[model samples]
Target chain A: MSGPDDMQGDMPEMTPDEILALDLALGALPREERRAAQLRLRSDPAFRALVEGFEADLSPLDATTDPVLPPRSVWEGILAETAPQPVRTAAPVSAPKPSLWNSLALWRGLGFAGTAAAAIALVTAAPQRQPLAPAEVATATPEAPPQMLAASLAGADGTPLLSATWDPLRGTVVITPAAKPEAEAAGTTPELWVIEGDKPPRSLGTIDISGPNAHAISSQRIAGLQPGSTLAISIEPMGGSPTGLPTGPVVATGKLSAI
Target chain B: MHGPVVRAPASPGAAELVQLLGRAADGDAAAFRDFYDRTSAKLFGIILRILPDRGEAEDVLQEVYVTIWRKAAEFDSTRASPVTWAATIARNRSIDRLRARASRPAAPLETAHDVADAAPMADALIDTMRGAASVHAALAALEPRQAAAIRSCYFEGLTYEALAEREGVPVGTLKSWVRRGILRMRAAMAEAGATA
Candidate 1:
């Protein structure tokens, strides 16, 4: 619908080759033109050479760019999203369409059931202590934001597999796995790791992949909760990684950004 | 655009980068991690400049690597260096995101000062390839408006129409400027290489 707004006033007539080269460089060509160029890239040596030359000329713009470090969670998210170890879920006759694992509603819709109830009970039964907000009574803090900084651990397909939240006030890390990962065959337990800056992940504790599990994080360990730290879930052997590192594929992971 | 020199981990040279990419193509997680570590920051910067939102840039950066993971094997070093190939992908994806948002009234352009400005890599890195210096020299030789058109088009991934709109110039003038700018830079860079 929107043509390059029909170039106005006294345009010099250009050769088709020059226009094609410029169009490729700017990616301004319509879809059909782009497809034709791509076909030319494969089939027409002269055209390919022309395109590559333009790419070379323009590439310095890329080379001189300032480098900005992305948040640690980005790489972790990439790993969790792309790490394609075979998922042990029962292979269905037809594969289910890929779902958005990042949706909190999807997890909530799955009926966290008793695990959800237990999470509330644990939050309540545990000392109603507010380490930082001493002025306000802990009893009044809402269920979500104030008490917990959560990471939704998803499978390779972005299916929400586990939810790990760091409850700073309670000094505990709560992990609620949505459903049993069939990967739990033969005594393998899901281990949690705190992935921090360029450091080898440190084990938070082992968690049951089939149910809700909580680990009391010592004050010394809570220091890792600095923004950008991640809670990574990996399927490890019965006793967890023998070397105190993540020995298995990181199945699910989420970042621990401060609220 | 000049700023304080910030030294970074020198780019992994072309050969090693290609090797890492090939390994990643074969589904080697460790190799992919190494590839990501070396390039993500640079790629993030490019995307951030175009998008100007940290969260959106991060999301797009993640998408770039996932695309890289799937398509690493398709990288033909004979045609382009690893950085060029990957940066092209990043640029294209960022543009796609920009175009998708064009229909709606987008947020005001965040000025360069407003974006979290990281110190630029020092000249040593910039000059590692003689081609880069020549390219910069070439850009410097252009008329100021022509050079700005080229940079804004390449860096922001703006189409001729969008750039024309932003500059309040006729699309024909903007296109001519950009086309002439590219041709001029090509000659200047080739000459610089000849001297080298």
Candidate 2:
């Protein structure tokens, strides 16, 4: 009624094409321009839902709440691994050259680096670094800041996932999942919480409960971490809960630091 | 944008295993001892596949190792090759900083690598692909131009501007083409039961 294209009198209609374009755009933009785009999309209810479904793709990352980097020593460990050839190794003018076995040791180190890279290649489709020798490591670009993890949601249960620690630094907690989630189908998503003391669970986020896969609970999922017993994930809604309490059943559970 | 909600079938032997990625991230003399014992040449194979900068690809190696150190916990043996999973993560990270916004008219296909991981969880992913193939077939049934636009948008990551450039049409018209194409494609994919 406010805009010229508004269906003030006649019901509006959208061709499938308009809906698709909007669906495509929905992947790039947010829901704010729905009014203007709605006209382009012809305000079709089914199309709108389709667009919503498309946007749902990025939810997995959203559910995670870690600072990309953890407080763990892994970052330091990585730095140490490629700690560099000192960048300026004193020009090595008069030092005695190392023997062939030393060279073999270096080759073995290189081989190890190579193997590690290969192992990573076999696991993730992501690129990994070549193995570094005992020397020749270089300093990383200081400007490339590590990713930051943050809390996203909370729930009725006493457990929550925590924020993520960026690359270069990572620590971990493992959880044993309950039997098949459908074993307790309440028609809600499994909620995750970071638990500490006797306090209510600090909601981290929720995990998908629709399937029968073992969900990995990472520290990068806390809503607002507090001192708690462990990180627990329960079920909740797509957008998550308005209340902090989790109304869903617990799926995977783990302690942040087994105390 | 929210990429896709479909849970990427769990990654097996993902980069999260400490025993797997310790040396790479550790960069320590002792750790690298273990690191090299695991994965290597495969990492190079994938990086070399896409990134032409051998030096740069090698540079990414360090980051990948560091990522492994910090993320080994996230890896699951049920997903895919540690290499493929790690490669995907590395590629995504590399492109994340280099990626252009959706509004850009030029689609960087040369720089883009298709999201193909090795064949471990290939079974799970293959199921999705079979499903996608059905959808693709359904898409094939649509008007050629219309389907082209949808394919360009969904799989190719093209903007409307780029679509127009590819088709040599006006932006507004291209916009219309994409919209219509998607509508038909969505219907087709859904009817085929390949959609999530």
Candidate 3:
């Protein structure tokens, strides 16, 4: 398959180690060779350095290709997969818990049926907190058993900032904000916390103030969702409070109630 | 050897990405989302080039981000820039998918032409990065066949055996071309870094 006069002269010779590193970096090694090279990478610092060097050197090529915005569904899929799953708990003596897929179907089937009742409960429970708009309540399909626990959080000035709903069966909390929270100070972020009587606050993770977000709760933490427990938002350093307790002033607070 | 340059919009600086990754490691989904918004397009570009099929490429993209989330703690800023680290993951995952398939699909026409033409697309598009120009410059300096072999191997994730068959050459010859090209490029990059 060679040309009559292929130009093979003046080519520099590469050591086998260098070849191995190049192949590994390029993802070109056969399966067996790849496994062997990977093992070598862990044990051989010099070989590892070679691979890293090649990877760094070759990385600039990434900038050459035109960036294409992947469809939004890709991000949605990522969120679904990466969202925390309900921690497995032992089956109760009486009845087995439904599988996640089954619960999700049941949840969808009950959609909007209980929203009006839930909104009324939210209004009567906290007069200071702004109620969900009438338009939102008007869209309810019909009365289905209420299956969600909800809270309407407000700032100290009595202005509604956000609302939260906990779906116990799905083990997810959906947070919908009325408006974007004020910009955080440099090096800090707005964190969500669940605080029950006497115990220290548990972080629900940093909240996205710009839009609605859903977070899965583990069964152990789900105990914090009792009717009188409080959900608060506080400003914490980038990742969150290192001490596992709120270190800044509370920006908003609301009480959880079953609707 | 340069092709038409397609400039990417300005992205978050490296330091910001590092910070975002740190927060992500701490389980900050918001920080993770911000990171994804800033970086996904570029990583998707890298994946789509290797995989070609939109569905396959998008699936691989999802897998890559999930990996980034799980492995954010392992990122070492001292070793590589955040973009490079993420890009490496994307490339490796896409290549893994490529290799795992029962039979390699025919190379897409644009990719085949790019390799055959030996056009240094990287040099044209990556001029902003400090040493990028030199890497592509060195690539352009290589013999055309050697350069083609390197590009095919890197961008298409073609193994020596696969590439050799495609080019109607011995696998050893294909490997030789890539190895020689890599050494020259590395040396050129080092020289450029030293001078800079």
| Candidates sorted on lDDT, descending | 3, 1, 2
Candidate 3 C-alpha lDDT tens digits along B2-38: 1112223234467778899899978899999988887
Clashes of each: 0, 113, 0
Predicted structure 3: lDDT:
0.65
TM-scores, each model vs. reference:
0.54, 0.33, 0.55
Give all candidates' CA lDDT scores. Answer: 0.61, 0.38, 0.65
Cα lDDT tens digits, model 2, A48-167, are: 344444432211211111111111343343455344453436657455433221321211111111111111111111224587765545654323333322221111111122222212
lDDT of 2 by residue, B1-196 (tens): 2123233343343333334454444334455534433343334334433343444445444456554554444454443334444544443333221222223334344353333334233122233344445556655766677666665544333445555777887766665555544444445555555344
Clashing pairs in 1: none
For every model in order, the TM-score on chain A comes to 0.43, 0.26, 0.43
lDDT of 2 at A28: 19
Interface RMSD for candidates 1 onward, in order: 12.9, 14.3, 15.3
Q: Mark the 10 consecutive residues where model 1 chain A has the least summed lDDT.
A: A113-122
1 or 2, greater by lDDT: 1
Question: Candidate 1 lDDT, tens digit per residue, A129-159?
Answer: 4566645655554546344576766433234
DockQ of 3: 0.19
What is the per-residue lDDT of model 3 for residues A14-77, given as tens digits with 9 covering 90 to 100? 5667767878897777654654464344335577777777787777766666676778999997
Q: For model 2, what TM-score does chain A reach?
A: 0.26
Model 1 agreement with the true structure over B1-196: per-residue lDDT tens digits: 1111221223446667888889997879899898887778888888877787778888878877876775676677666667777777777566655654524244344453134346444332342345567778888988888888888777766677777888999888787777766766777776666556
Off by over 4 Å in 1: A1-15, A28-48, A86-259, B1-12, B104-129
